[model samples]
Target chain A: MNIHIIGGGAVGLFFAAQWCEKHAVTLWTRTEQQAEMISRGGIRVLENHMENIYPVNSKKIESLYVEGDLVVVAVKQYHMKEVLPLLQNAAAQSVLFLQNGMSHLDFLEQVPHPHLYAASVEHGLAKIDGRTIQVNGRNKTNIGSLRSGTAGIIDQLQTGSFRFDWNENSYHMLIEKMAANAIINPLTALLKVKNGEIAENARFRAIAKDLSREFASVFSYKTAEDTFQSVLSICTKTADNESSMLKDMKAGNLTEIDAIVGVLLKTAEKNHRSVPAFQLLYNMIKGKENTPEFMSK
Target chain B: MNIHIIGGGAVGLFFAAQWCEKHAVTLWTRTEQQAEMISRGGIRVLENHMENIYPVNSKKIESLYVEGDLVVVAVKQYHMKEVLPLLQNAAAQSVLFLQNGMSHLDFLEQVPHPHLYAASVEHGLAKIDGRTIQVNGRNKTNIGSLRSGTAGIIDQLQTGSFRFDWNENSYHMLIEKMAANAIINPLTALLKVKNGEIAENARFRAIAKDLSREFASVFSYKTAEDTFQSVLSICTKTADNESSMLKDMKAGNLTEIDAIVGVLLKTAEKNHRSVPAFQLLYNMIKGKENTPEFMSK
Candidate 1:
């Protein structure tokens, strides 16, 4: 199967390197320099203290013809709107979205593709350079169709190092990941602590509980205790990992606060439920993003 | 007038230095070393970029006879419970309670003194050393009786460098100050930023607005905007000052989170109002306080 990944970020490069091992894969990067570097040097993958470079086709996003069996949209959610139109005109047989947060659910509904898949990538990936990617942790990627059954491209992509699971309910999978991001991302960013610190610190644990209750209310979870435990477990599992939001803050880059927490706040307002914790976290992340240092970048 | 100031911390030492100028004053500190230092070298006051050392009498808290005309309780709210029994047995005609939160209101009601006054110290003060204090800013100290008219000690305290205002409604003044502390203290401590950063930063300002609204709801303020403006002004006025709570966090000491935000949360619960912001901030501050580093200290 011919696969085209629509982002050159860590997620995009990681998947392209894995899928290119067994299938025809091409990476589309926004910058010509990154595309030229990857095309000449190949995509580098560092896992378990070992480095392997995979030869794959690379092209600038603007020059892409978008004719492939599967096109995976792996860009940040904040960049989704600008990239959506390009995907709409693509002649791909199926499109897969691997973005975080539920904000993209609205955009998914409007897609004209016959076979549309939304995925939650749980794998930990970091971009070492323009063409090199580091695999911090290998985890399963949850994928489900928005309007149809599992796409045939999944079987081709789910070979070797690329692992994919078919989620029965795409919304449920997306919401679950969204809930975790909503709680973990902004908090880890705001506290300037690792993911595990939220659960390790008692006071921060209490906050995690309160935030879980608020999420339970908006998501209609059966009990807040269950939600809190799920969040705590995630914190323990990713204890040492600095959250993507925190990394964004440190890099002086804009975070996906609007897509994650902003969506929840709007839902809370519509439900006439008060979620002050989410409100504060959202404002703080937004404030940090708006600071002079971040704005200049 | 003979004034007895309890607690040899910054506020205690500050008032001791100011009151000793016109009135016979005695400072009671928990340690004999601090007391001996003050007794030997006198209390130094740095105001207006000038230093003045005033000769003052100092005694250890254990040796306190409590036989002064006016007993000024200038300790932290956390220390109030342990020292309250001593103040109850004191031979002072009247007692003045200067505390940060509304939690001390209950303790003030239990005092046997005929004239009971609770004053909010608005002045910015920092302890240079055990025997020296620097006045960051001189603001009016609002003093009023919890149940009666203006206490006679107000007249004595109103003179000299110590400015005091007769607050007709002590509860009102206390609530106003508590609201500001509720917003400023935990945020500054948790963010590890100065007081002015709260107002200068847009994101933190949004948080200040939300916190102010929650406080206004519990305290029955006319509007959240007015309360938010008042809190912002306090941030501006003391821009360079590190809040006592923030200072406590930096020093790895326990803060008065319970006295300040704890009271507001309890009040909100009693009123059947939700305050997630305060609950989170309280938990964060309490969590930082309960850390191993802070606990060992």
Candidate 2:
């Protein structure tokens, strides 16, 4: 099988490295430096279970053929607008998105893609010191086809990369994952605290629960309670993993708070749900994110 | 004038130091060490405008003379229940409370003694390093009798110690002070931010306004707008000051959140006004205060 990976971030590089052992894989990266590094040396995956850097082909997407059996879109949600259009030849192929949230629904609806597989991953992977990569744990990863006819795509990807599953109720799974993300991610980021801090605080829990309730209302499901419990479990599972949101905030980078929390809030507004707690949380985080140092201090 | 000051915290020591300049003053304290400090070396008040260690007699009040020219009770609200009997002597003559929030109402209802002056303070004084006191800024002090025929008391105190004013409407003044304390104190404390943070974040201002609205509804007054504006002014005046509530939270001591926020919220319930934000803030602070580090961290 021939595979083309878009966006040479952690997930993209990880998947390329994993599949290159059995299949011909080409990672489409934007930078000449990264492309040259991967073309010369496959990919370095410092996995918790195994540690090694294998060689693979990496090239600029414009110079390589996009007509592949599978194309993995691993770009940030904000970057998907530009990157999605670049995969013109792979419109008929199954595209697996290994990103965090489902903010690409508008793009998904607009584009006539043949098959789509959405995944919500709790894997602790980080590009260490900008040169190497490290996977702290073999965390749970869920993947499923959005369309009913493409169940086989989910089956084919079940080969030993990480744990992946198929669900008839894939939308519920996405919303559940989304609810958890909205609650934990922004708070961990805003507070500059670990994932465990949310569970440790009843106020934080209440705020998270309220926000989840708003999301559940929009999705027409009551999953916040279960999802909140799952969040606590994830805290214990990945206790040492600094959440992406937290890292973004610490680095003074703009967090994907809009994709994770803002989307849920907008959806709730569209659904006409009253979410005062979430509204307060949203306002607080937005203020913290936009606040100047003098005012904040 | 002969005066006796109870509770050797910032406010008590604050008024004691001021009143001792011209009058015979005694500071009653619980901690023998603090009592000894005041008795031997005198009370040191280092104000931005002035600095002095004025000598004053210090002792524990097992009992007191039933007659005095003036007395100021400045204990915390929670301690008021146990200390009311102790104030019986002072209540017979002339008594002024220089404490935060509407905590004095409980004592006023139970013991309706004549010649009572319920005062509200915005003076920014704090005990910096146990022995040393720091006055951050000058804020007006308001004093008035809860009942009639105490104009002389208000006038006498206003003429001397501090920048004082007499309000004919003392209940309204109490409510106004309650509104200010309810708004400014808890937010600065719980958010672990300075006073200016409230003005910087509009959400905190909204919460402050909501709390004030709740107070207005219960007390049948229209001080919400004025009180909120005053709070913003305070945010500027004490931009660098850590509020008493914040100080208490940092010290792991019980915050006056109850006296400031809780009392107002309870009043809101009595008047059938829903104070969602204030109730939420109160619950969070109370929960954090009661729970141990294991539960909250």
All candidates: DockQ: 0.42, 0.21
Global fold similarity of model 2 (TM-score): 0.82
Among incorrect, acceptable, medium and high, the docking class of model 1 is acceptable
- Candidate 1 chain A has its poorest 10 consecutive residues by lDDT at A288-297
Tens-place lDDT digits, model 2, residues B64-176: 55456777788888777777878875534667777677766777866545667788877877887534678887677878786554566644555444778778888778777
Q: In candidate 2, what are the lDDT values of residues A69-109, reduced to their tens digit?
A: 77778877877777766865464466777666668766776
- Per DockQ, the best of the predicted structures is 1
How much is A160 displaced in model 1, in angstroms? 4.0
- Per-residue lDDT tens digits for candidate 1, residues A176-264, read 88888998998887666789999998878888899999998988854688778978988888787878898788777889998889999
Q: Per-prediction TM-score, please?
A: 0.90, 0.82
Candidate 2 at residue B14, lDDT? 75
Q: What are the per-residue Cα lDDT tens digits for candidate 1 across B1-297?
A: 888898998999988888887889998889999999999999999988999998999988874556778889998999998888878778877788888888888786678887777889889998889999999999889888875546555676776667888878888989988888989999887676789999999889989999988888899954799899999999999998989997887677778999999999999999999888899888777767844343222
